[model samples]
Target chain A: MLARRVIPCLDVDKGRVVKGTKFVNLTDEGDPAELAERYAREGADEIVFLDITAAHEGRATMLDVVRRTASRAFVPLTVGGGVRSVQEMHDVLRAGADKVSFNTAAVAAPELLTACAERFGSQAVVCAIDARRLPRTDGAGQTWEVVTHGGRRATDLDAVSWALRVVELGAGELLVTSIDRDGTRSGFDTELLASIASRVRVPVIASGGASSPEDFVTAVRDGKADAVLAASIFHRRMHSIASVKAAMAAAGLPVRPVGEAVA
Target chain B: MTGSKPRIAILDYGAANLVSITHGLAAVGADVVVAAEPSALAGADALVVPGVGAAASAMTHLRERGLVEPLRNWVRAGKPCLGICLGFELLFDASDEGDAETLGFLAGRTVALRDAPTLPHIGWNVVRAVRPHPLFDGIPDGSYFYFVHSFAPVPADEGVVVARTDHGRPFVSAVARGSLYGLQFHPEKSSDAGLRLLSNFLRLVAANAETNARAGAALGSEVA
Candidate 1:
């Protein structure tokens, strides 16, 4: 059986990690590499860095940050935010990102998904979907509408249908994030996750609104997520990854112990 | 044979994760080189065929660089070699992926994993070493390693299979025959278990070199 992965996400801006990432052991609080290395030591199965910088010059700086982080952390790194072109994807992967997540770019041009998957393998392409539940205009109960550009813009694309198309377009992994439940600390939108997980054949990573260890359990058990990704919960020191892994293990889930996999 | 550092050549055929593999090798104190030309691999103490792309493209890249025959000869001579992921798939005769013709170093056919609940089989899964080998020297059985692939090789000879894992059903996770080694999992990205596996490979290369040196010295002494 595959072990359920626990990932800690860092929101980076101008080559610096932002959003209250003030862990004590870290020498440079702004440095993404130091934070990533700390997370790796804490047994984060993977680390994601979302570069929120919008400037052209800032993108190069983010790539440098990515290169440094990749050198420091041995685990798989997934970099997203402002990834619009295949050249940018190549630059990130060449800087040592194992996978590149495309949300805004993928929605704008669905063929970009196919193109990147062709240049790089599908395993290198991660289709990140940010969805928000909306009241069904068609007399139905509700529907998860796909949103892009940091969840500010909504599209007509249905969440479930988009997931199937991305998989068909050769995306190896699907990262479904719920915009409504994000940073709410309420819990994961397992309903959103369950809908996508059932439709896609690739590994689904449930992101946003992960407040508790049980929330992770629900994400895996009820939502059927292959992995759970969180930002503020782990970054704010609410719970350590080891404690979460322990809780998951107690709940009869398989997890890798920190520092035990190495010699 | 002459230097203290073990020269390990990682065959570069436009593989995606070349940087990580090189970094993993560097962590184990092995001198790593990314060889695009076949000549660069000739003097290597061990050759690693690191791959991450599709089968047909991987084959095309290797052929374009004129590396097919040299890799075949290297394996035939029984020098230490290792393959990772798509590199492992390329060791077989053929693959269902793009109808690719592989190196055929191992007598097997690579096919799509049957009844897979997931397509790529991503994430970490336990791999159990079925037979004792130096490749798994310090690693424990049923240890988790990261794997990302839809196709797996079915070796013609079962004896080559040293480790087995399952995503949907049981499949060959690691195969070893003398100096030739292949692993479907990515040891570089697998955290500690992965580093340990790469460390073990480095040790194997050193051990193989020492044995060959001793044999050569003895033969020279007899001739003298």
Candidate 2:
């Protein structure tokens, strides 16, 4: 059986980690590679580098960061952000990323996903869907609208349908983020997750609003997420990855023990 | 052969990503070369065939680069060779995915993982050793390694099987026969356990080179 992955996401901008973290042992905590290595040592199943760099020049720096991260951290890496073309995705993969996620660009031009998937396998293509809960109207139980640019803009597309569309468009995986619950620490939007995850054939990674280890359990049990991703909790040392896995393991979820996979 | 690092040729058919695998081989103290041409396999102690995506297209790329025969010859010559992921699938006779005939170094065929809950089976999964081998020297049985594929090979020769991992059902994860090795998992992306496996492979290649050298010296002649 596949072990449910517990991933720590780092927001990178211009080759540096966006969120400030102060680890006691490291000299340069801002360096994405150093932090990623630390997280891997702490038993992060995989590392997600969300390259939020806005400027064009910063893209090169992110590639360097990916290179440095790959050299230091031997874990699977997925880089998302600013990848618009097949060539750009190629650059990230050549820079040592195992997978690349598409968000805004994928929404604008969905054929990008197919083209990228054809060049690189669908296994290497990931579609990140940011969704926000829409208010109940006409006695509807629940609904979500697709959002882009970090949940600032909303598209007319329904989140559930969009997920299926992306998969059909050749996305191997879906990173479903709840814009409504992002950074809220309330919990994951299980309703939103279930809607898409249950429908799509690809694995769905639940993102946003993860504060505790139990939240991860619910994400899988309720949302039916194949993997769970969180940022601040692991970053701020609020909770250790071991604790999260312990919680999951206690809940009868299969999890890889930290520091046990290595010799 | 005693102290010198082993040279490895990683066949690049262009589409498959070679970054992590290349860095991984180098990190394991093996001199790495991303060889795109048949002549690039020269002077290398071992060859690594790393690929992903469709078998037909992958086979096409190898054919276009004129690497098909050399790869088969390299394995037929019994030089140390390792194939990762799709490269593992290509070891078989044919694939159901692309309906394409692959390199039949081993007797088998690639098929969709039976009863798989997930299509891609993308994540860390436990690889249980069916038999002991030097490739798993330091790695423990049931250790998790990163995997990203939907199809797995059913080996015709069960004697070559080294490890089996279950996603839906038990599937061959690692195989070893003579100097040939095939892993369905990506050691390059498997973190620590992965690096250790690659290190062990390097050691295996180095040891084989030594054994060959000693045999040549006993014959009182160098084959080359």
Candidate 3:
């Protein structure tokens, strides 16, 4: 009876929180630490801070941000994007991040996942897979391909198959993002999510397209996802964590109630 | 220090998450200390073992710090002790992760949850009590606990297993024997259910102290 998690993702650029529409045309939201504290106080189960500027700057500012946020957040914080080396991962953990996520680094080296998992426990390592659906090339088939570099580069790797590989490499969780449906506010791709969840035994965190609390419920109930991550709905004040939990409860999904009241 | 707050020592074997564990215990009003020295464990009315990482590495750290025998002696002396996650696995005789040897205080072996419906069993799942234990006191039957592990201990003695959770099959989730209690879930991360469990654990510590005082008084009277 673990409650399903409702995560709010913060895209950080130049040490500030920013929200982009369709992964472009970014608009500054607020200070990263302030936003994180607000979400934590509002009952967010966990907070994800992505250093979108890491790749461009060739360095990570997320660690400092993580340290400042961790000092006050009082909840689990996951820092991702541009985490390329073991040193970087270690720095993030030392900065008080409960978990460190990898994107380009994990795909490029692959063994980096195993190394990180070995040095730091698997529970500390998360593999973020950005995927997009591709048209059938073999005459009567359609599939999703794993994309890297902020969903710009498309690899021949199948999303489901790569998910299994990463788990085998000792990834504790899979953060699967559907590039096709990202920021659409249309809801998660239920079929795609279910397919991935059925393939892997690790917890699947559905990301990319979530407009309503119903989207979260669908992702957990039908998609069988352990949690759901949303940016737009949460960033734009479209929904709150309390409302999402209420909706999930109404949908018959077991969710942790707000406030501390022992059951 | 009588009638004052009972001092709780959290054994830091170099590989555990002491910060979070200490924070959680403090949130419940427990006087918590991250004890790294053998002498610190001496005056504690209760002990907490919080761990992360491989079994072999954890054991190595414990042994290097001369904590193995002291921990066993503390529990044997009937001091209340609670182990969380990796701490639970370390209480077993052996683990499949890395090396086979373990603390061997508990009669069980830790095996990988490979064939389980889900590996790593992350997030929350309802834990059902199979036996009556003080740890589950005041908590409901199907209370959920937060878990994140790929391996769990299966105690040899069925009576020692206090709770079981079904991920694919019903497996042991919590265990209690005498004063030694271990939880496979991260109670610090388990929300209210976790806080209630910690409260019950504190009660057990108080009860143990009272029993110890009575025994000491009886011994003194016998000498007289």
Candidate 4:
């Protein structure tokens, strides 16, 4: 059986980890490689580096960051944000990233998913859907609308339908972030996650509103997510990965124990 | 073998990513080289064929890079070689994916993993060893390794299979015979156990070289 993955997501700008880490232990929290290695040592199942860089030079620097991180961390890494083309995706993968995730680009050109998947296999292609819950009108219950650019813009495409479409477009994995719950510390939008996870055949990684280890458990049990990703909670050290995995294990879900002996 | 680093050459035949494997080996104390040409494999203690993608396209890249025969010959010589992911698939007689014929170093056909709930079984899964091998030295009986694949080889000779993993059904996850070893999972991305496994492989490479050196010395003594 596969163990549920716990990933720590980092935002990189200008090739540096964008200054949210409150690790008093780390000498240079801005260094992605250093921070990533620390997280891997702490038993992070995977590491995600979202390139929030906007400058052209930032792109080259992000590649360098990935190269350095892969050299040291030795865990599966998914790089998302600002990857727009097959060539760009190729560059990121070649730089030592295990997977390349697309969000805005994928929404703008869904064919990019097919192209990248065809070129690198579906296993290397990840689609990130940022969705904001729509208000229920006329007893419609609740539905989510696809949002992009960190929920700043909304697309008319329904989240569930877009998820199915992205899967059809050859995205091997889906990173579903609930914009409504993001940064709210309210908990994951399990309804939103289940709606998409149940519909998609590929793995769904739940993100947004992870404030505690119980949230991680809920993300898996209720949201039906194959993996759980969080940023602030982990970065702020409010909850450790070990605690989250322990919670999941206590909840009867499979999770790799921290400090598991290789022998 | 004792004092110097064992040089391991990684074959680069248009695989999606070779950097991780290169760094993985380097971090494990092996002298790593990203070799794209046959001549580049010279003087190296081992050749590692690492790749991820469709079998047909992989074979094409190997053919285009003139690596098909070199890789087969490397295995034929009983030299230390490791095949990873798609490279592992390429070792079989054929692949069900794209109906591609692969390097027939091993007697098997790469087929879709039976009864898999997911088309691409991607994640950390248990790798249960079937028999003892140095390749898994110090590694636990059922260590979780990261895997991302749809098909696994069905070896005609089950004796060669060293480990198995299940998605919906059991499938060969690792294999060992002679000087060759193969893994379906990406050890480079499997964290600590992976690094440990690579360290063990390097030790095996050094051990294999020592045995060969001793055999050569014995043969020279006889000739003398």
Candidate 5:
């Protein structure tokens, strides 16, 4: 049986790892590669490096960050943000990233997904969709709208429908983040995650509002997410990965045992 | 000869990731070399074909460099050779995804799994050994191996399959016949189980090389 993945996401800006509340007012944490190596040592299944910088300075710094992190990190690394072209995707992959994720760039040009899939194989391209629940119009039904440009602009695209389309466009995995619950420290929006996971054939990774180990359990067990991505809880050392896995094991979720620690 | 390290050759057709594969083999204590030329492969005790990217593109690189015939000759010689993922699929008759021509060393067709549960079967999957083979010596029957692929081989001769795994349903996950082996999983990324598998392959390579050398010596004595 395949084990549920536990991923720690690091927000990188100008090549340094940073953390902020609701994607605002960021603060530096440490060297991206050092932090990534620590997470890898602590039994993280994968690490996601999101370049939160604006598009003007280019994705060069992020590419260098990925190369540095990939040298120290043995587990799979996912690089996202400002990934606009096939050349950028190829550069990140060549720099040792196992997967390159696209958010704004993918939505801007949908055919980029197909072209990337054709070139790098679908498994290497991850389509990240950030969504937030909107006010009900029919007086009872709420809608999930796709948010782009780092959750600044709301598109007419429905999250669930767009998820299916992206899969058809050859996205091997979907990283769905709930903007409303992001950085809230409450829990994952299981309902929203389940809605998208139910519709898509590919693996869905649930991100945002994972404050505790129970949240991760809920995301995998109830939400049926293939993986759970968290930030604050891990970044601040609120809970170690070992403790989380121990909790997941106690809850009866299959997780790989942490082998003997290597120096 | 008994304690000598096994000399394994990783066939480099100008497109494969030779560095990573060499590092992985070296980590497991095997004496490895990136054999880019046909003659270098002959001197190797065992062969490994590691690759990334599309099947058709890799095949083109191999043929353009005039390596296809020598590789076929090496496999026919019955020396231990293992192919990873794309390398493994290329050993089959052909791939339907890109209509790519393969080495046809193994009797199989690599086809894409359509309308199944998932596209690329990424992450970990158990490689349940369905038949006994030397490559699976110490590896447990249900040991899990990491996989990342969209297409898999459907062997023309089913007898060559040594293991099967389930995604949508049970499919051939590994194949072995005599000294030839093909694994549809990335052993370098599989942690401990993967390292053990590589160790076993090294042992098999050394034993096969010894056997071949002895046979050659016996023939020489008979001729004299």
Candidate 6:
């Protein structure tokens, strides 16, 4: 059986990890490679670096960050955000990223998923969907809608349907973030996650609104997520990865043991 | 640190990402080289064939670079060689993927993973040793390793299989015969156990070189 993955997302801007980390233990929090190395020691199953950089010049610096982090860390590293073209995706992979996740670009041009999956196997291509629950105008029922541009813009596409379509288009995995629960610390939108996870056969990673280790367990046991990703909780040092894995193990879910001789 | 080190060649066919393997081998103190052409692989103590893209396209790239025959000859001569992921699948007789024929180094057929709940079995899973092999010398019996694939090879002779892992069904995760090895999982990304496994391969390479040199020296003494 595959162990459930616990990932810590690092938001990168201008080649440095953004200043959201509030933990005192993280020395040199500006360097992504250093922080990633620390996370690996803390037993992070994977690392997700979201390139929050805007300008082209900054993007090049972000690639350097990826190269450095990949050299130091051995676990799977996923670089996402602002990856708009196939060439950019190639650059990230060439820089040693194991997987690349696309959000706005995938929404704007669905064909990009096919093109990427063709060039760099589906295993390396990920479709990150940010969705929110919205009430129906027809007075019928509420539906989860796909939102993009950092959750500022909404699309007519339903989340569940879009997920099934991306899988058909050869998306090996899906990273679905609940915009409603994001930064709320209210727990994951299990209804939305279960809806999507059941409809698609690919592994789904549930992101956003995990404030505690129990929430991580709920994300897997109830939300049916194959993996769980959090940012502030881990960044703020509210819970260590070992504590979360212990919680998951206590909940009967299998997680890889940390500090058992892997560096 | 030493003048005489294990000279390792990492075969690059524009298929998979070779950086991780190169870095992993380097971390273990092995002198690594990324090469494509046959001449570039010459004078190397061992070779590593790493694959990431489609199997058919990987075979196309290998044939285009004229590396097929040379690779077969190298492994046939009992030289140390390691095949990873798609490269592992490429060692079989044929694959259902693109109906492509492979190196035929191992008698097997590559088929889509049956009953797999997921298409690409991504993430870490435990690998159980089926038989004692040097590739897993220091590694524990059920050490965790990362795997991402949609298909797995079913070897004709199961005895060559050194380890087994199950996603939806029991399948050959690692196979070894003589000096040729095929691992379905990515050891470079598997963290500590992976580094240890790569180091073991390097040790095996050095040991093999020593044994061959001693045999040649004994032959020379007999002739004298």
DockQ of each: 0.68, 0.72, 0.32, 0.80, 0.30, 0.64
TM-score, structure 5 vs. true: 0.86
TM-score of 2: 0.96
Enumerate clash totals for all models, in the order shown: 3, 0, 4, 0, 0, 0
Indicate the docking level reached by candidate 2.
medium
Model 5's alpha-carbon lDDT is 0.81
* Candidate 1 lDDT (Cα, 0 to 1): 0.88
State the displacement of the C-alpha of residue A95, model 2, in Å, after optimal TM-score superposition: 1.2
Off by over 4 Å in 5: A13-16, A22-38, A53-73, A250-252, A260-263, B1-22, B30-45, B132-141, B213-224
Which candidate tops TM-score? 4
For each of the candidates, what fraction of the native contacts does it recover?
A: 0.62, 0.76, 0.35, 0.84, 0.24, 0.59
Candidate 1 residue-wise lDDT at B142: 86
Cα lDDT tens digits, model 1, B122-214, are 888999988998888788788888888888999999999999988889899999989999999999888878888899998889999999889
Per-residue lDDT of model 6, residues B74-157, tens digit only:
998899999999989998999998788988999989998999887789998999999999888777788889898888999999
Q: List the residue pairs that clash in candidate 2.
A: none
lDDT of candidates 1 onward, in order = 0.88, 0.90, 0.81, 0.90, 0.81, 0.88
Q: Which stretches of candidate 2 lie over 4 Å from their true place?
A: A20-29, A261-263, B1-3, B221-224
lDDT, candidate 6, residue B20? 80
* Residue A3 error, candidate 5, Å: 2.6
**Predicted candidate 1 versus true structure: per-residue lDDT over A1-263, tens digit per residue:** 78899999998878888884222232224689999989988899999998777687898898888788776678889998888888888888878888999889899898998998888889889999999998868767557999987678889999999999999997999999999988788999999999999888899999989998999999999999999999988888999999889889989998887667444
The reply for model 6, stretches above 4 Å from the true place, is A21-28, A136-141, A261-263
Better of 4 and 5 by TM-score: 4
Best by DockQ: 4
Which 10 consecutive positions of candidate 4 chain A have the poorest summed lDDT?
Answer: A19-28
Q: On residues B32-132, what C-alpha lDDT tens digit does candidate 3 reach at each position?
A: 87789789986788999987677888888889999989998887777888888889998889999886699887988998874676666776678898878
lDDT per residue as tens, model 5, B1-224: 23487888888774323444565576778888888788787567889987666788889889987889988888888978899888999999999868997999998788986555665777666678887876667666776667778888899998999898777777788888888989988776555566667888888888888898899999999999
Off by over 4 Å in 4: A19-29, A139-141, B1-3
User: In model 6, how large is the Cα lDDT of residue B86?
Assistant: 92
